[model samples]
Target: ITAKGKPQISTMRVIYQPQQGVTIVQWQFEQSIGWLPWEKLGSIMNDKILGPMMEKNLDQLRRLIEAETSSL
Candidate 1:
């Protein structure tokens, strides 16, 4: 998806599976280091921002799912 006249792309795959009556989500993000031979920026982004952001988003997803499940 492109937004604001800017070009961007992500290499991520999300898989959903049910285990023991619960939903399990497996997510993988493929790293990209374009035009730069070094990976320092990618490493820092993953460690400092992307990692925590993903965790927080997953937590929010879980809570929303559980809330709706309980109401069902």
Candidate 2:
């Protein structure tokens, strides 16, 4: 899913996920999303500097996870 872009930089990735037979989600959680280092979803969700944002983020993630696991 990664690719090269400029002479020295890489092209950003734009991820997509399908739901109900349609594309319903798109996100890029990489630290490359900002000025920080590269980080995927899991580590970012548990990061301390972003602890405040995590409360809300994790809650949403929990809801999504529950919806996936329990159809709730």
Candidate 3:
């Protein structure tokens, strides 16, 4: 909630890059809208399929968001 008592949604994106062999992750949030709402979300990615790296990144993201929100 904000000072005006409205709710907000936090968004996250997980990206997987192959060939070069690495992954990238990003996070963002929505705040103070007059009406429209956005969904708070999570996602996963992998080089070939939903494999180890994907799972690992997803787990890390979950932990990160959990820890961040828990403090609020």
Candidate 4:
């Protein structure tokens, strides 16, 4: 998804794969740094924000899956 009022921005793509007993969530980040000096901004945002957010989302998914599986 594109953000508001920004030309050079970052976007994320997510995919999920069902494994034998677990699900793998893949997060891909794409950043557009046209005419930028370095990739520091992109790296910092991924490391600080995206990484933690993905981790939390995965943890929540795991809990929900486990709860449903236990009920079945």
Candidate 5:
């Protein structure tokens, strides 16, 4: 629960798949909002709120992976 007394839940998944000779990485994020009217309304803004942050995080992860593998 948040300080506002609303329940919040989130999940993240990372998937790796090998196709031919290259590996692909994919991720998913999900959040559960409480059953309050305001919460439901606020859910509408979740994508706009979270998209940029998520993209930044993914870019960091990609850079880290590239740096780590460059020597191999």
Candidate 6:
């Protein structure tokens, strides 16, 4: 999914492991920086920039899921 005014692609996947009785959710965001040298260099900091945001989002998702499931 593309966020408003954001030039990036986001993907989410849910995988269930019946044997392990667990589910795994994965999220990824990808942004393309042009082949310019500066852009290529900036790409190296992508994780440092986006990692905390991703973790926060995932934590919120987990809390929401747990709340809903607990109600059921």
Models, CA RMSD each: 4.5, 10.8, 15.7, 4.3, 2.9, 3.9
**Regarding TM-score, does 1 or 3 come out ahead?**
1
| Better model by lDDT: candidate 1 vs candidate 2 | 1
lDDT of 3 by residue, 1-72 (tens): 776686656566777789876566655444445533332121222223434655677689778977998999
Which prediction has more favorable lDDT, 4 or 5?
5
TM-score of each: 0.59, 0.29, 0.35, 0.55, 0.61, 0.71
lDDT digits (tens) for residues 1-72 of candidate 4: 336344444444444555654455555555544455455666577578777887787789779978999999
lDDT agreement of model 4 with the native: 0.62
**Model 1 lDDT tens row, 1-72:** 223343334444555555645456655454544555445575566668777787788789889989998999
- Candidate 2 lDDT over 13-59, as tens digits, reads 33445554333233223333334454345346645555566457656
lDDT of each: 0.61, 0.46, 0.57, 0.62, 0.70, 0.82
Estimate the lDDT of model 6.
0.82
lDDT of 3: 0.57
Model 3 stretches with alpha carbons more than 4 Å out? 1-5, 33-72
Worst 10 residues of 3 by lDDT: 38-47
Ranking by TM-score: 6, 5, 1, 4, 3, 2
Task: Please report how far candidate 2 places residue 19 from its true position, in Å.
Answer: 32
| lDDT of prediction 2 | 0.46
TM-score of 6: 0.71
Writing each residue's lDDT as its tens digit, candidate 5 over 1-72 gives 667765665555655555654555555555568788977777768777877787888889889988999978
Clashing pairs in 1: none
Evaluate model 2: give its TM-score: 0.29
Task: Give the top-scoring candidate (TM-score).
Answer: 6
lDDT of candidate 6 over 1-72, digit per residue (tens): 223353777789999999998889999978777778976676668877888899999999999999999999
